[model samples]
Target: MKRLTITTLLAVALLSGCSSKEEVIPDVPPSNLYATAQTALQSGNWTSAIEQLEALDSRYPFGAYSDQVQLDLIYAYYKSDDLALGEATIERFLRLNPDHPQADWVVYMRGLTHMAQDRSFMHDMFNINRFDRDPTPSRQAFTDFKYLLERYPESEYGADAKARMIFLKNRLANYDLATADFYVRREAWIAAINRCQQVQRLYPDTEAARESLKLEKTAYEKLNLQKEVERTEKMMKLNPAK
Candidate 1:
């Protein structure tokens, strides 16, 4: 009986080990793994690409294709809509290769990752009104792109980065205005005025600045503050709302 119990235990252990065989990673050359990752990427199989790329990165951290492998992995995460991983990967790459030649691109990608989080894909695709959403991600992305342009003034991505920065600014301004409008609708005059001023103060160059001035003046009027309303009116007259 004792021998049978021991044999049964050994058999169970062996079966468990054997059943897990499919989970084992095959011993492939790093180059081959990289090529497989590349093939997955080319096929637009982002999840597969990420799996292989992650395996390569884990198995051969300092391999010849380390830098490109990381970059491709970041892009795969982004394409797969796993933005948190994409962002974390970018931070890791930047930390590891601070003075890398492609650092600017990585920074730009980091910004894009945050931008992708600003609104859901369906929202952007359907042109939905999601301005009421939190603006933190947009703010983070704007700072990222701003740093990119400032640090890498002549980077190849300069032009496109600038365009995205402008878009982010507008999005932020819109968020502020939406919040201000919400306060106004609720008759929270002070809060509404504060949000309007915030938009104007931070984004005076944006088109939304004009709308902010309009809302600010309306808030002043609602509060029956003639002096404040007159001041806002003069400013509005100088920069009429478009």
Candidate 2:
């Protein structure tokens, strides 16, 4: 009986060792999924790329790669023109990492997703690539870039962010100018003046500045605002002859 009990204990220990040795560790880290997605994206296999990324999110909810994966997923969705998915991914990332180091980049990418979706009617009409009149996305892009500049001045991407902000600001100012011109053509002095004021308030240093001031002067004159018209005209005259 003693011999049998000892043999049974030895057998159990052997079984335990075999079980431990056979235990399967996960073959990949969550970051590996992101890397795979990147490869797929570069290959233009957008569907597969997104699937791999989503898998990373699902399988490793709190893994070390979560934040980075979330960011990359946003880009993947945007590259594929999956605007709704891109927006949703960004919203989720914001919820998770509101104070993340790269939060500004996330915000900028979100706006970019919307900008990508937006298209101009003129583009369709003329078979040319034109942008939409929607200033909201461009405005958001500017805000994101502005935040990066102000909060992380020493950031590696700071200069690029500022440059993009300038571009977006100019685009937004152009939209305002275009709308003001449309109002002028229709003899809508109040609307024209309001639009010009928008450019002055929102984009004072942009190329649209001088032209916007000129439009404001014409609008005030059309509305019979004598003093306001004279004030705007004086300002325009003082502006370097451009």
Candidate 3:
């Protein structure tokens, strides 16, 4: 009776272990799954949309809606603030369908994703300065937008991309100017002059132009370059902001 009791308990434990394992997900109809995902997206339920789209992709990887599912997943990831996932999804889509008719849109979204990642809530809401922040993401976004405009000049997103590019350029120039100011404070005249020159050469017509000219004048004066000092001084004088 004791041995039998032990055996019964062991059997129960085994059954409990088996039941505790995860249940296999039931197969959902692909069309229904896609529709559900679309509905979730429309309702701004990003998490739910991601789950349904992922299920659809896993179950019907080669179905008619496969491409659209991938695209929607990218957008869902972005809207959900899963920027890293969104970037990975964009790269996957580009690699898998380089010649897709909607490739331009995907590229544009990639640029926007990088830009969004570079921005902080404080920067957006409080107008906090981002000049001292990392410029890698901004540079990446600029490259992406430039690529989109050059590769797909007629893309519907071209105009907006151009506008974003302009903003990024100004930001980048300002960042360089900020660095120049730091170098000036350190009395690294050559470094400061080089940075100011870079801003003037790469980001012409930007608000940073006046600052760059002023920094260049200061650096040149410190370095005893009278010719360059006079030149930069003249440029600064012509600018109304100076």
1 or 2, greater by TM-score? 1
Please give the range of 10 consecutive residues that has the lowest summed lDDT in model 1.
18-27
Residue-level lDDT for 59 in candidate 3: 81
Model 2 quality (TM-score): 0.70
State the local distance difference test value for candidate 2: 0.78
Q: Compute the lDDT of residue 134 as modeled in candidate 3.
A: 88
What's the ranking of the predictions by lDDT, best on top? 1, 3, 2
Model 2 Cα lDDT, one tens digit per residue, 58-169: 8887888788778878988888778889999898998988889888778677657756655555676888733226677666667667766786677777777777777787
lDDT of each: 0.90, 0.78, 0.90
Candidate 1 lDDT over residue span 59-129, tens digit each? 89998999999999999999999998898899999999999999999999999999889878689789987
Q: lDDT by residue for model 3 over 92-117, one digit each (tens)? A: 99999999999999999999999988
On TM-score, who's better, 2 or 3? 3
User: Runs in model 3 with CA error above 4 Å?
Assistant: 1-26
Clashes within 3 Å, all models in order:
0, 0, 0
Candidate 2, poorest ten consecutive residues by summed lDDT: 21-30
Candidate ranking under TM-score, highest first, comes to 1, 3, 2
